[model samples]
Target: MAYTAKDASTTLFRYLNITEQSIKVIENTNKRGFIYNTANGEKCVIFIYPISHKSDNSKNFFDTRDSGAYERGVSWNYALQNKLKYFCFAVHDQVEKYNDYVFSLECQEKIIEKVSGTLNGSRIGAGTQVVIPNDYIPNKQFERIFTKNGFFIAVIHRDNIIDYIDKYDNRPYLIDDSLIELDELETNDEDSSQSVALDDEYLSKLSRNRILFGAPGTGKSYKLNEDREKCFADGNYERVTFHPNYSYAQFVGTYKPKPKFRTDGTEYVSYEFVPGPFLRTWINAQNSIKSRTNKNYLLIVEEINRANVAAVFGDVFQLLDRKTDGTSEYEIATSEDMREYLIKECGFEADEIATIKIPSNMYIWATMNSADQGVLPMDSAFKRRWNFEYIGINQGSSKIKDSEITLKPYGTVKWNMLRIKINDGLTEAGVNEDKLIGPFFLSDKELKSLSIDEIFKSKLIMYLFEDVLKHRKGKIFKSDFNTFSKIIDAYNEGEEIFDFDVVSFLPDESNEESALGSVAEEPGKYSTENE
Candidate 1:
């Protein structure tokens, strides 16, 4: 049977199990090609040209002296100039010497050198080959070229053509198109949309590092917990609390004295470098990236503003400036002890010990309460690097159910409503917005389970006396019960019981003059006496 360009195009499409509608055949006097679009919208072409041979023997793979060889070299240069990812295959007829043909390493090297010249300094090697392997194709490896009889198949794509290669064994004989399984190809195409959506969501959540900030009890830390669980598994994440005493030695890693037991059972103190949460998370991220797991490692910092971030981060602060690709902009040098520890205990290569960088896959998430008055202020330069998300107070009924407290005469009051009332009272008293009550303050499940008196004594009274009244004394209440002790006595002994009316302390919307004043003031001061 005589072979033709049309025959080759038909065979290529049949091998790939692609429909005719998805591929167009291009037949020319010099070459035959197939044009198609990948699932990712990349245009691709597979071109095949006949190689001149001096004899019918397969041993004579190509006639290098012939004009066909020069034309083939020109074609390769054209492909390179056009920036197309091309794979070349040399075809031959069956020869008596070899039952099955395999391109020798020597021939592969020659082909690579010839293609490299055409590429103009571009690298080309054995990896560029598209072949049907008799044995198993290793996992993560791609096969691109195939050969049968006197036909050589060449594939070119705008993107990485290797990604399209199927990891399955090729039969010695031409298999029917119906036998080919296109399930992997279809699955990959379907996953493309999902992958894009995931990327968008990931970018929105955090481009580099992010800090979720809000008033206390606004659920900033809770948001982090939900996100951590959604994005990563337990082993892939680590959480740490930052406070006034937090230091670089405790965050990154440090040399500390550890007790070691001798052979005789007596203990001896030895100085050794210990890895901290940040370092451990970084190491795990590096390993995951090296293994090509496509997973992210998370580091959660609670109460980030509580610590002197500059002092705690030290040289590691430089790592916060990330490149568009998400890698650290600078590699900070590690301490000698850290270097030694990384190489000896962490399995880092010797050459990698000089400097350390936070990997792109290692994400840092932090939570900060805006209500924290004693925290070390973060500078503009430091604050500008991180993405900030504000968690607002949630007034949902479900959330309110977590802390519904019942009182005499008042019946049951939802924490959400109480929060709104208290915030309104604070606003009327001219207190700062940051000092306003957040719904989370009274939403604890344990607090919700408490009796009315217990709830008032344990949470509400403490919040009023310690947080609110401590800051805005007599300005928030009437002169008779201006102090917390007076208010507590009124509620406990039921003396001057009218002062214990919590609702009376909230602003009244019906009276315009008293709208900006708390109901705790003398009745006739802001509003007219009852008619």
Candidate 2:
């Protein structure tokens, strides 16, 4: 048996010693535990109070007003309701006798016996005991006679409310205050949950060696730039755009002449050394990690294949290799050496000799456009250093309310699968590999704002698919003007649009018998019959 708001009046009469001519479970539109004047729909919430102040240590019951009922303060009553339905209860301390005499009555004990059987039991670490059940059924299990004022609370599962009570009680345990606080605060203010907390574990899990590879015009650069700003704002990232003109000196460091005056009143100059962005970023990441043990840093190398990988990386690449991957390090000559040595080895100016070493904290992220005519494939050695993720123009990828979109895969995973489908479809049509867009190019924020028709009118879809189609064997996809139109039509009227079956993942609904026929009618789809 499971306890519900319907049992509220009977339970209160038997346990709390409150008597009223009539009582009704009031369900409200708000998401909080509110007392109102109606009961209908699953959207309503019901609030439960301690049965009797004398039976539990919780002081709420003892604070009854002149009307002889427990009085919830202003905050509890006036707070905005914005959370899922929840049941609240307070337990009494056995040692306190202030109100115990009333609960000792035989009639009260009989009610306790009936409800105790459905309670769940658990030991919370110390000698403390807790009992939660689907329904308060006497003789089945022990009931929670006491509540730990502010220390212990349970968020019961709607369905498992019975099993939880039978198994967990009088067990030692620790409770999570933050979890409960988040729920209560949402109920208090009706605010949606924001970004997950920025903690050490999350930072440590960041993809340090990511490569955002995509076709041209798919918005890879935009997303990369956005993430770069976020990482930099946290003071843990450095950005450098790569090009054919970029040299080792520009990336690492170089020595130059500075004007000076000679002792003999003759004009003279002296050589001075200067550091570049790469070295600066390496040093900064190391210093940041030293101060904040769990922090991570990012270095964005735009158009990574534009420059010679070996010439640019020189010696630092090996030291930056992921430790988990077991790659070997390389030894190389430094920018600084005796002028004579530099002259003999690489024919550099004598003033350029000085030593600089790469730090270990630096991690590299790069972007490569697969569709650029001038772009050359990265060398095998350089390619092994990065982890590539393809970005594509996808509506789901750029939608903000993707989780609520009601798809088979639900959220981001839906976008990933769709990207795979596009690639597979294009492959079947004999499209070349070069034209495939990387899925990561688009963000969720960009998708939901535009309708399918609006997106198609922009010809962005044709621009995206054309590159891959050009490399294919047939002229069937060659007409850019028509290709865009067909692509748009498919997106708008496709039958498989809702292929990701999300409803199947939903939990069983309560009251299975009433919904049995409807659930059985669609065994493969959303079913409530077994609830």
Candidate 3:
């Protein structure tokens, strides 16, 4: 049983000892401050906000507010150390007018328990609050704390929670669920600083190729976008979208004609070189080169396979193969050189060509839809040059659940199981290897906006097992198409399946072939190999 919003809300209200009506307006100042209701002898405060913003609102306990004259004399320290059975607050606003204020000293022990319960029942938010430290020292025990709603509020030190509210009114403007802290928060600034501390020698360990793979909807693109921004050294990164027609000229550079109109009303043809995204990223990385540190450039190639990789990428592909001396051997005009070249060679002025680049400090990240036919027949030469990671369809769990924009009822485990089951069913029917659903099929945008049940069937047919689509509809025909259709149709025709719980499928490492191909239940796996 995992924690839920309702459970958190109920526990918080219980801690406050208040009815639903007692909560005034829920504040989301993003600052880390605990709203402890000393009204009860319990060392607990009912978080006035509901589950809607609970995760966002409660982060770290940094400092306390200016409870002003109203907060004075209320000893939180006294409540923690001694077996003080009673704690009280003089509220500027009367909370008792709405609800009965029946509190007993016996409730003191229960207050901490209730607060613990609220904290324990939910893990969706940011900060993980452990026991409240008394005599909390800032530099020693506590650094700074933020509210759940992402407000950087206070610095906690022994006996005092100091306020340091900023422009956000202590609110976190942007929340990235995907960038969850895998490890515990570091107290030391040196270890936890945002700056990439590694030098050239350290960069060698990270030089090996990295691949992002999973079925569709697993957030490959989303993660790539995040890394795109982070991978650059000095805010100099480039991104390129690959399509079927992307040419070699696009990746490198090509001479093209542009119309130039003079003030004298005479129009003439001007030849200029245009640099593409990959070229631009490579160029930017070189421009920001710093001494001592090996400068790194990021070139993100989205849908890498849509274009004929070999045809469009040609000599660059050869260049990528030999990671030796990555700078271009030929002396060519850069974007700056292109401007100079056009003015000198073709008689055009400086303010014409957009941007240019040299190949040094360039790194490439190419994304591809594994399910697309155009991308399926990737040449071996192309494949050997880069690391490959498969993004499968069932990989939807993490992206769906962690996002604040959408609250997926289906959790990661559940979603993965569903994908496994679907894949198994499709493989049993002999669907083509390239036809299986990947992340491209399911739409996060669609799922976020529409309910799963509404678009479930169509999504299954259209995106989930798209490989099945061409096989059933086209020639070179193979497999029991109706069998796959029946499984999908049956799932759609059911109220029970909609009520399905993912926990039903326990983790199975043995039958994990469902990740790539579904192992047949027969004597051996069906030989889908065309040979």
Candidate 4:
């Protein structure tokens, strides 16, 4: 049976010889273990079964064949992997019976001191036993040292666990601090307050070739740029926007004819293979990996869904799968023209020029808006190979510092309040949340400098006409205007004529009227807009 926090606390209190009432259980969950608050306000967690290297059956302690044993092993491994401070206990016999166990603080201390050295040794394994000190006795009846066979329990202080979780909360696995080797500190960087830790934790979980998908205005493209800046240097990254005209010839490489001028001013045409963004980025990454530069290369594809992905990738799709060592899973045959170009211009070996492979250090990241129309649909086979992350609409206020704006007649308003009102209006009009405006729609500088009329005319008006109206027809505006052009004409006439305030544009409560002056009850149409 799975043990609860109460069960662990009861067992812990009995073994530690502490009064149960003196401690309060703060949190007890399978992932976090049992956190208990002591009388003095200090917190700690108890591990029901902790595996050690010296104990018998240590090798099979974590074996999945035994469900009960496997669970205990996982819990113990999590604590040790995260470098949490804990106490361990080994029950001698009758593992199922809890009443026979007795709490001894002296015994616990001696065991910890002995096991500390073993943890630093090379042969450490699950269930490994510690060499108890000679002064410690297992029982009064027996003078010789006794080894336990039941199970191990570990106690970890809460502070250490909290810190570890805070730093790596997004990570899929607990970070093993023991395996980390620190590098020498740089002398010139002594005054640097910035953390040297790499921001590749999210990338580690993602496939080498991945895409970010979300509703329009969700900041998908913005996040890709952010990642490029954070994880890669200037020379290490390249970017391209995909469109309906994008093809394999444009994405990869193709033979193109160029005019060659002669001395007599007569022009002659020469055909040469022109390399595209993918091939160029791949070759650069391959060179970096071969030279052991330890640098990453990233290729960012914006509006990836706008083009036919399968057609653009062609035979190169096979190169996306990476081996365990980060090299391409397969080397695909290249076209004769590409082979010639690779050998002559790219400096590839004669034998290697026949095939091409994506380097492991090369990463391909794309962004797609779920609301886009006219995009070529990707099949399951192609999408399953790439990891996808969804960027949701910003639920909080804009990150812009000291953001506040004042409308001539509406008085001063916070940017967050404006966003809330706009979003509320959009929602009331039956517009999907994904199509709602995002925080980055207007920048900090624009909000501070531009007048309210200019801001509304430039940003919100354009959004309504080009985006909301184009998709939802005449549903979002007041009933007086039947078309987007009519609304624009009305707005141009005078600011006072039409209330640009978000609340005024909301659907009428009594009739659920459309902006076109019709009693429309249908939900607003949805559409994707390129960022």
Which candidate tops TM-score?
1
| Cα lDDT computed for each candidate against the true fold | 0.52, 0.39, 0.39, 0.51
User: Candidate 3 on 307-367: residue-level lDDT in tens?
Assistant: 7878887655545543445554334333454465334422223543343224556667656
TM-score of 2: 0.38
Ranked by lDDT, top first: 1, 4, 3, 2
lDDT of 2 by residue, 349-388 (tens): 3343343333445667677775665555666666665666
Q: Ranking by TM-score, best first?
A: 1, 4, 3, 2
- 247 Cα displacement, candidate 2 (Å): 2.2
Off by over 4 Å in 4: 1-206, 262-267, 406-411, 449-452, 469-475, 489-531
Per residue, candidate 4 scores C-alpha lDDT tens digits across 157-212 of 22222232223211112223442122221212211212233366755655577687
Candidate 2's error at 390, in angstroms? Answer: 5.1
Q: What C-alpha lDDT does candidate 3 achieve relative to the native structure?
A: 0.39
Query: Any runs in candidate 1 off by more than 4 Å, and if so which?
Result: 1-204, 394-398, 401-403, 494-531
Q: What lDDT is reached at residue 448 by model 1?
A: 53
How much is the lDDT of residue 500 in candidate 4? 48
lDDT, residue 518, candidate 4? 27
Point out the higher-scoring one by lDDT: 3 or 4. Answer: 4
Evaluation by TM-score, superior candidate among 3 and 4:
4
TM-scores across all candidates? Answer: 0.56, 0.38, 0.44, 0.54
Put down candidate 1 lDDT per residue, 1-531, tens digits, no spaces.
443434443544544457667765433214444455545555444444222223443223322223233333333344333433333333222222221122211111122223222211223221222222322121221212333211222222212222432211111112233433322212122212323333436444454588876566666677677666556643456688999999999999887775656657799987867667788778767755654444577889999999999999889888988887788989998888888876654446668768878888889988887566678898877887787765554322235443556655455555555566666656677766655665566556645565756676666766666876675654545557766777677667644322224555433435423432332222112211110
What is the overall TM-score of model 4 with all chains considered together? Answer: 0.54
* Reference-based lDDT, residue 228, model 1: 68
